[model samples]
Target: MSGETPLPATDPRSSPTRRISIVHVRSGVHILPREMLGTSTFGVAMKLLKWLPTQVVDRFLLIMAKMMIGDTEKYGLKRPKVGPLELKNTTGKTPVLDVGALSLIRDERIKIVSEVESLTSDGARFVDGGEMAFHAVVFATGYKSNVPLWLKDAGGVLTAEGKPEEHPFPNGEKGIYFVGFSGKGLLGASVDAIKTALDVSARWTRLSETKDVVGL
Candidate 1:
């Protein structure tokens, strides 16, 4: 199993700039006991939490924040944060927020990165003295975003196959605007996008009013 062990954090389908298979262990997991969702382990905890119906995770987060070594609120954020759409820790294990950053816990097996090398789906090749595989390989590197999904603009059509719709998104028509493409956090992105849209709409409305005045 050592040789076939799953490669670390790099998503094979995500990157092509520099192919690397590093040994990565997950960095984040929440295992507070009072959690009702019971995300006691890892892996699926984050995913399952997304579908849960309570603020248990958030509560634990706040509690954990208080217990941490530094400025508690700054670790996650500082606000009177209360939201109905909550992630659940339905899994028996403590739900991990960022699976890519998940940490090792006693309950969960620590997955380490190993065999950081080029992926060679292609035929093996011989170097000056040794053999190397993979003429070219692709990797899937995960991304980070602070925003939630619903907040982000639907943008293109969401297809059944999860393929993005075929519409010129945020195209500058009579009224269209985009806030963030390479922005940070999923939630932030949505807020920014919406702000743009609103601003665009307001400008359009004002221009229309002026046009009506001239026509009158």
Candidate 2:
């Protein structure tokens, strides 16, 4: 989260390239109920409600949204066109509370920067007319599944569309398995990891026994 850069020998004020600037650009959308941020609460709620019909879940979410976030228009936020359950199911993501720009606006420590124009050999130049000399850059990005590409046959563990199959770690392959691959979110993923580990251990034990018997 932090980095150090060597300063130029000359005074920074006298040299144009001696200063460093850090810029962070992002989509301003923020979802809230700040207490729920960075927790698996939303995913657990979704799992518990999964048994209910989609319509029922949707209606429930709509009510909850109203109670949690009132008057979206007043806050310059738009009401979701679809239900939370629908969105979660479609995106394979559990809903998490987000309060977009509100957090940044309230925090005095964060200085928002304008769009980046380009990166020079020494540092980054902002479109608004300033440049910074940075020795390191930290980027926070989301994750993507690369398991399919790693498997001998991608379809062995994934569906035709690249989604994890119901039984993410399927049988019929020797010495090949998966762990921590679940569409059910973190809680489900942990359960899947444990179960898969147990299964794999048992399978290996049986294989070793069979090999000993064959040698006998």
Candidate 3:
């Protein structure tokens, strides 16, 4: 946000026709269009990546990012520093692409603030001792799992942060099982649900047979 990129003032992309300004505050992020992810080419690349070495796959993603997002440096922004896979590994979720986000960001009507010192009813104060007044502020920061707060005991299978510790998808402990903990999204959740239902049904049938044999 602090760096200067010599863009022509006449550039229509950054036109200052509107008085409303949007301030984007964040650490570095990785951005890719949702449509790109759905492409057949991308899907094929993913399948091929599984057979390649990690180093090669990472370099391949780096090249793919440049091809998709263009040269971020040319805009005087150093964001999208982490690739998609790296971001997913660190955060446990993939980035959601907002349509036209890139264009909105590069507009002259928008400002980027990387650090904030404080916030008040009036506006936000930056770490650099600068302040700006705003009519409203919206926080788009993601959510955290609240499982730790309500789950009584997890038998060392879950972390204090409400995430599974034993495996990416938690192994069933006692009678408790977890679904949608794999960070693979809804499709992963659906698969987990089906597996859980089948396992529970099998256990129930065995219990019923045991009770019948005992005449209870």
Candidate 4:
């Protein structure tokens, strides 16, 4: 909203032309070391776990977590009882494929707060009586698949929980399609996009052929 004119919702052509800017927000001041964040440890662990049995993968991940984070109790962090791969599979959360950035735990510039209490007329007010002024603030919280209010009458394309009823595409719309809904992470999403593109191209060809046949 700050950088460019908003696209008209009714025009599908404008969807591809729109651009998004991401602003990352963290609530903690204690940043992790650059070495921990940027290391290939997690990536290598994931790759090794891919072909292993689930039980073996779980054990391997638990070992890796101990090696990577070391003594969590000393750092005041509570490690989950379940392994990372198991937790991700059960929760349907995206897998972390890379760790290439410094965490807020080790970053000195960040001032951690308990929680943001409210938005004052000037800026954000923390629950601990701290306040900061800024021109813009963006929340990097996770996503929910809420259907736009304007699309209420479009039939049952989305489920009651707002997830797409169909994988790779939703129902009740001819041209409407979705990519990266597989929850398979970035590389998987790229492959999904390629397959979706091929499918759409074939559908368009069929539609064009039908028009030609009707004319003939």
List residue ranges in candidate 1 displaced over 4 A. Answer: 1-110, 119-138, 142-176
Arrange candidates by lDDT, highest first: which order?
Answer: 3, 2, 4, 1
Collision count for each candidate, in order: 36, 8, 0, 8
Local distance difference test, candidate 1: 0.38
Error of 3 at 163 (Å): 3.5
Point out the higher-scoring one by lDDT: 2 or 3.
Answer: 3
Please name the candidate that would achieve the greatest lDDT relative to the true structure. Answer: 3
lDDT of 3: 0.58
lDDT of 4 at 117: 67
Runs of candidate 4 exceeding 4 Å displacement? 1-42, 94-141, 150-152, 166-173, 184-188, 205-216
Q: Write model 2 residue lDDT over 24-132, tens digit each, in one string.
A: 4333322434332345436544665768887686676556556665544343343446665565556544444645533433342233455557766866667789876
Which should have the higher lDDT, number 1 or number 4?
4
The lDDT values for all models are 0.38, 0.51, 0.58, 0.47
Cα shift from native, residue 64, model 1 (Å): 2.2
User: Where is model 4 poorest over a 10-residue stretch in terms of lDDT?
Assistant: 1-10
Worst 10 residues of 1 by lDDT: 84-93
Of the two candidates 2 and 4, the one with more favorable lDDT, higher being better, is 2
Error of 3 at 100 (Å): 0.8
Candidates in order, TM-scores: namely 0.34, 0.48, 0.66, 0.50
Each prediction's RMSD to truth:
14.8, 8.6, 6.7, 11.8
The TM-score of candidate 4 is: 0.50
Give the alpha carbon lDDT tens digit for every residue of 1-216 in model 1: 111223243334434864433332222223222222344222223454577635764654545534532231223222233421232213112222333222222222322332333344542222223323333423333433443344345444344333333444455433434444422335446766776677678778989999999999
